[model samples]
Target: MTLVLKAMALTCLVLLLLQNAPGVGAQMYPDFKLQQPQSSVVVIKGDTLTLNCTLSGSGPVGAVKWVKGSGSDNQTVYEQKGSFPRVMRAVSAPSNDFTIRISNVSLEDAGTYYCVKFRKGIVDDVVFRKGGGTEVSVHARPSVPVVSGPSHRAVPGQSVPFTCSAKEFSPRDIKVKWLKNSTLVRAEPPHITPELSNSSYRMSSTVQVKLSEDDVRSELTCKVQHRTLAAPLRKTYALHQALRVPPSVSVVAAPSGAVEVNKTVNFTCRVQGFYPGAVTVSWLENGTVMNAGSSTQPTETSRGLFELNDTVTVQAGEEKSGSRFTCLVVHEDQEPISGTGILRVTAPALGENNEGLIGDSSDILLSSPGLWLGLLLDKALLAVILFFLFKRILP
Candidate 1:
């Protein structure tokens, strides 16, 4: 009887060991598994995130539930065949792939999550098994960078200070770089300031560089880098000179020499080497301003500097001899500068003979006989007027 009992006990022990064998349970029904056992996901704010938990061999599964938290304090974030949250949804059936999607993820959605498969036993018992899990981290990207300074203008060998700033980012892993004309600027030491706010970070970087004449036309750019961005963000500034200069003014008369009566001449006024091109050129005849023959546009000589030309036409007359012409240049916030020229007119002369000499000249020839006769007549009239004046004075 004792041998029979021992045989039965041994048989029972062998059956129990076979049931608890390592390969036996897997051969019959594999343990519940996930395609990716563990994962980590990082996303930016206002962006969508998807976590897929593909189930392998979870048999007799009732439903799939996504829980947020670790160990015992876990809370169901989403469950298949249940009321879904506005931002959370089950993308596929738990039996296939227990995938969940979170739309418009924000900082509040950052946490560890797990996919659990629920199975009901033959009685009133319930069993839970881990399918997969992931750690989700949601971050806010920094604001668009801003570049500012005390002045946009600087002189050669002067120190120019500039500040570049970004706000409201996460993870504290942002990089800032300064560039001049698309090339990296590393000579100047950068001053960086970072502040923490509600677990997020804000940053500001500053640089002071001594500028030379060669950097006058260079473009300075601030580049920012963060994990949330696919490419670095950039801001650019063009430098200027604060010291101002006035234009040089000069005038030239076309068709030089003494002009005859009823002849037109052009006086061109050139203004050069001026910055901030706000200048006006005016023609002056006998100290009076004339508004004729003006240019509509000024030419750019260099950056922020310009050159201009203005002309005036004048008709020569008998009374206009020895008349003075001036070109007055008016600049903004500066004293006016001017250049001057003179006009000379001469009348034709007459022959030495007392006989009346008459001739017509459609085109005035200065050496013609008619001009000499005209000049002699002018001299005789003057003598007669003077004699009358003297006779009246004697009486």
Candidate 2:
């Protein structure tokens, strides 16, 4: 019995040695070979992707399958018995070619793919061979950027927010920038989000801008950069659309000092340094609104501000003396601003008696001072002559 046991042990050791030998193990499956021709591939999003897997020599192959990833994280891609909606065999059945085509490929499809061969076993399938992995890189171009600004219009020195956004892109790394009038502007870091359904990415960037009068013609641009883009994408927003500048108003009379009765005088209303050009100007005589006036269109200045001139003619009548002419300017739905000028009227010259009343009242008072002094001297001289005559007669 001991000798029989020894012989059995020797037989088992010899079998183990043969199994462990390299050439001997290779001889068991010398004719089996699985090949994956492609080393790597890149596919754009929403397009089709093809992975080639061909078998040259086969021995005890029971099934062929494609898998993504490795070990614990691996997931089956293509299997003979399973149904995959977006996956299909590239070639017809009854062939050694195992190439597959994936339709509507997305970022989630990007990974290492492997072609594997399984051998039928008593209870479970055994991995027979595996091909070198084919690394798949999916690339998708970002959508055109959209820019938005604050809802309410901004005045000078007011800070407002602007946002830029792009969506449905791949390869998470992206760059965004803000520019004002072709010059770079500092902004906050972009926010990136992932799409769970399509495995895509979305990004948004924001910037705060302080408005100025110079921004009337300025442009704000949002620029995006990505590896898939040949050139950076740009979207511009006109700064004038978000800016408001109140107008500076003033009223000036043509005959500044005073005018003769019945003389025609002009009062000009000047509206300057306003943005967006549109404005309403009206004149007021005393406290009542005037209907007669000529207003010019608002014209842009070299500095990008706007200016307008409105003129009204009035006769310097006796009843209209000391009347106040006011210019009321309304801009951008804001409260009206006003500037005023006073009208002074004088009677016409009527010989020497009305010579003092021909000009302004202040000027008449200044010119009559010398005449008053002369009259006082004449009276004194007459009194002195009479006194001397009386003294000689009394003596």
Candidate 3:
């Protein structure tokens, strides 16, 4: 009976202790959440970044810290109560609101960031919770792609070379392409270069093409794609009818036969073998320029080249003999080219069937000084002989 009574006493005490024991439940830490959902944030190298974090739940906030990177590389960049040289903290209106401002971001700042909260636990030493992470991306925009070479103007059956380049872009992945009349073209591999500091990369590419006559109306373009660009950057160049061969000048004199003195003569300068036909013809007499008469418009030849003619008329005279006449051709394709001819002015000679015929002496004597003297001496001798004959007949 005593044993039974002891057992009932022990059961009563055990029941009382069980009623006073605390209930088992999951451990709780301070409620932490990111005001802005974790997302990609792109900014220039010199721009500022702002990250906001919010706290909830009923508990005294032990501490707040911002961590950067992942795995073993994780590093605490900013602490609420700790001093960070680069982070600028703004005064929070509400005590639960935390804002972190970072100025002068660089390549090293590009990574994921997290806002972590630490709280002291009742039984456990300490507990922590992390808000959503913000992915930070710092970038440098590349300079506008430059397209050069291939000649602004080119001729058919020629090999044209071109280059496209972009400098100082962050993140080495960049797309460069070539197009002719909006059609894709196969080009050589791009040449990528890292900056001396190794923080930025530059890219360049080249292409060579054999042009055809049909390509004269086509347009070529270089297109570039990058992360910082909203649209692809493009540079366009064209190849049209252009000069291929140098200009050639030739001088011709009218009346292919013997030259006459004090008569009208025509000098023609013909320029040929040049394309894009912007040319000027000049006539030079004894190294001095003279006014020209007529110039024909440039006309295309069978070879797709240009040819033009200019004429100047002058009266042949004695002084013109042995004088140098030059036909100068000035063209866009090359320096001025010239052709020269010497003027040969001669007096008319006596005809085989001379029936007192002067044989165009009127035009001849005007320029020949020696011929005038000879004619005067002949007339004086004839008068003297006629006087002698008349005196003899009278005797």
TM-score result, candidate 3: 0.56
Q: Residue by residue across 178-284, what tens digits does model 2's lDDT show?
A: 99987899998899999677867999999999999888989999999999888999999999989999999988889888999999999999999998889988888
Q: Which prediction has the highest lDDT against the true structure?
A: 2
Q: Cα deviation in Å at residue 108, candidate 1?
A: 3.4
Q: What TM-score number comes out for model 2? A: 0.71
lDDT of 3 by residue, 266-292 (tens): 778888777666887888999999887
All candidates' lDDT scores?
0.72, 0.89, 0.74
- The runs of at least 3 residues in candidate 2 whose Cα sits more than 4 Å from the true structure, single-residue gaps closed, are 1-29, 37-42, 59-63, 67-85, 88-95, 118-128, 135-139, 193-198, 351-395
Worst 10 residues of 2 by lDDT: 17-26
Clashing pairs in 1: 349-371, 349-372, 349-373, 349-375, 350-372, 350-373, 350-376
TM per candidate comes to 0.56, 0.71, 0.56
* Winner on lDDT (1 vs 2): 2
Residue 214 of model 2, lDDT score: 87
lDDT of 2: 0.89
